[model samples]
Target: MTRIAVRHLGPPRLTAGLDGAARLDWDAHRRVHPEPRPLTAARLVALAEEGRLHGRGGAAFPFARKARAVLDAARRRGRPVVVVNGTEGEPGSAKDKVLLCRAPHLVLDGATLAATALGATEIVLGVTDETAAESMERALAERGLDGRARVVRLPERFITGESGALIRGINGRRPVPPGRKVRASTKGVGGMPTLLSNAETYAQLAVLAGLGPRRYGSVGTPGEPGTVLLTVTGSARFPAVVETPAGAPLGHLLDLCGTRAGEGVLVGGYHGAWIPGDAAVGTRLSREGLAAVGGTLGAGIVMPLGRGTCPLGECARVVRYLAAESAGQCGPCRLGLPDLAGALAALAEGRDAAAACETVRRSARMAERRGACAHPDGTARFVLSALEVFAADAARHVDGGGCGRPVLGVLPADTDARLRLEVDWSRCDGHGLCADVLRGLVRMDEYGYPVIPGEPVPARLEDDARRAVARCPGLALRLVPRAQRGS
Candidate 1:
């Protein structure tokens, strides 16, 4: 694939000297980190404190706390392990993958630095995309870490990159949240302390180590130093991964990408909030900057929902996708999300549009803080932000039909197809047995026939689905793939 354009709005740290499609080899990586002084645990912590380094993977979590926790845990238990989260599962975000593919050695250098400082026994790069995987492999091989460091491929599911899920996958278990909090700082891979962080987070650390606190803190706001890598997509001259100083005006970056903020912009990723186009003009791209403006810099995904499309329809589609992507281990995932998606869909379709907004709000509240992962909460945040930003459009859609616009899918998604439960009408009579087997997923219609959701079946309900399919007397009920669903 051709390399994405890497533009710089202010001084560039992450994307420096790299143009479109240029992969940095070992030599280039060294220039970025020349004879890096090995950091003592305390010194690394101090540096992190000075720089105020934060994770680039959506959450904007402080990197110092995570590192300190791992250090304390290691001191009490044993040396920690370093895991570079190259598994970019968010469809709207490509910063991590771009770093992995274009600046592989820089990422490796950061991981190696952390590993050495912590006296880590292992280093693993968990990658999802094939291109990223190949690039990581080459970087490791070039550094002669083939024997020491390992690269593992992970599934492309959205929540698989969650810290707990990532550690679980590295531990030879399914890459899903353990239905409970599993702190990687204390109990991680092989039940040892693990310093798990996003790829860009590590790359930032490498930069910090090389540039030190004063030089690193020279740019951006004092609260958030250095540059941020963002995947800017939609309503643009070109969709590209951009690097800009932390406090740089959000509008400048949008202009650099040739974006026309038709409606408001969807700041962050699918799980992030939206900002009004006017509010975005002077908004900062940093965590503090965006937060002050009531938006998130999640996973560094910035997409402007341009005109010529229905904003509610676009949001509905994303809400449905988020609901489908749920880890399926929580009540919110099993019930609340689907309900919320339905409400949003109803509003988008102008079916009882007035009530649908209220329904959407209620569902979002119900879905909050009740999930194995942030999927539900993030999904809720996404929809609620939409409701707030597009209140006028929603009023029109509710009072009238739609805004007389098409969906036009400006947002990117893995699949537009919803998982559907189907029945073979010719095979046999209506069986209420399927409804009995799957309680929440399948129900009975006016007739005795079963009515199942066209939304994707909850991952937690796979057993129930199989049971329903197996117990069918005439083998009439079956699970239909999206490819078969006419929708």
Candidate 2:
């Protein structure tokens, strides 16, 4: 196997010296052969039809269909814009950053070709972290394609990378979605038609354009034929990026990661589901294969939960962090997520495990589709999966005092420490003013302590929420931002 040199800059990979144009290191794993040639829209479309290329960005939408949508919409109107989603806000996934830092030119080649094919005059590469954005910017300069493509910084929040939110951010608005549903392909970035896809997807397109379909299909499984970059972290000997065939076995990846047999595997990132330790079942890693087993290969984030840490406690901590990260744009997500987090915390504290499980179910149902974005739904899936996968742990917590092991904090937290508004039960006077003033922001529990919603207060309602914070009769409620919480 060929290994690409990558400079690890904390959670993301950063390239060195991006001030000027630099050549991408593609000698080992070039997706295309015969020295990539520029492909036009017609040829690209035909190749996509033949290769059956799909989005690598978890959605798995057909690439041909997306391209056609942009083309048709542009013809209906005028020129369309191509947006490369390199933000990769999924906490555990770093594949895009790997590609950007190591093989930056591959991504640029793909984006440029796609822009030309779609008749898009402008191309924007949306990246969140400073390193990846600079790497891509430098790559564009190396190719002397600076006039054709521009790189934009994306918001670091999880939901900010969604196509709609990205387009909204590009338009000088906050990187949050509007209340109503909107399609970017129809009206995006300055109200122009947009073709948006994952960074890797565009890179794959460049490869296809250069190599043609038949050659590109030679590597992976028939249904999903190509090489995929997977960031295999957790319990692995070498926790780095691995270029593997799309349908490579989960068992093989686990072995490569140096995980002991019988350990649980987190197939996807935070929003993904967990699976059992049967290595035999780890046949393939594609979306279809994972879906067949009621799981998903979301962004190719595979983490193995090693022994010694309390799985239940760790999962609860992750759930709490995910809850606090909610954008809080809609009623259900705003109301449901924190409650679910509370229940998970309760389970961690050795109280009401069964009831907490029920609360998780209820909260998930309430928050699923009501949010403007899919953050709530994805979070619900993650929490629900944890409940199912760790039934024994839940049972132990309910029947006994608690899970014996300490929380290892394998999952990332919203703050450096726990983020909750503490009510000095002794200091509390049941004025109900907090609830009255901030109905959506704070609700009085049975004991009169405020059960604050999980989502962030909308800009419109920020003042009202603050008013409730100020009007607390006992000065009981305090709004603690995640940064101040220290984890």
Which regions of candidate 1 deviate over 4 angstroms?
31-33, 416-487
TM-score of each: 0.90, 0.84
Give the least accurate 10-residue stretch of model 2, judged by summed lDDT: 7-16
Candidate 1 per-residue lDDT, tens place, 218-267, comes to: 88888888888888987777888988888888888888888866669988
lDDT of 2 by residue, 220-256 (tens): 7889977766777655556766667778777776666
| Model 2 ranges with Cα > 4 A deviation | 1-35, 261-263, 279-281, 414-469, 476-487
TM value for model 2: 0.84
Model 1 / residue 285 / CA error / Å = 1.2
**Backbone clashes, candidate 2:** 7
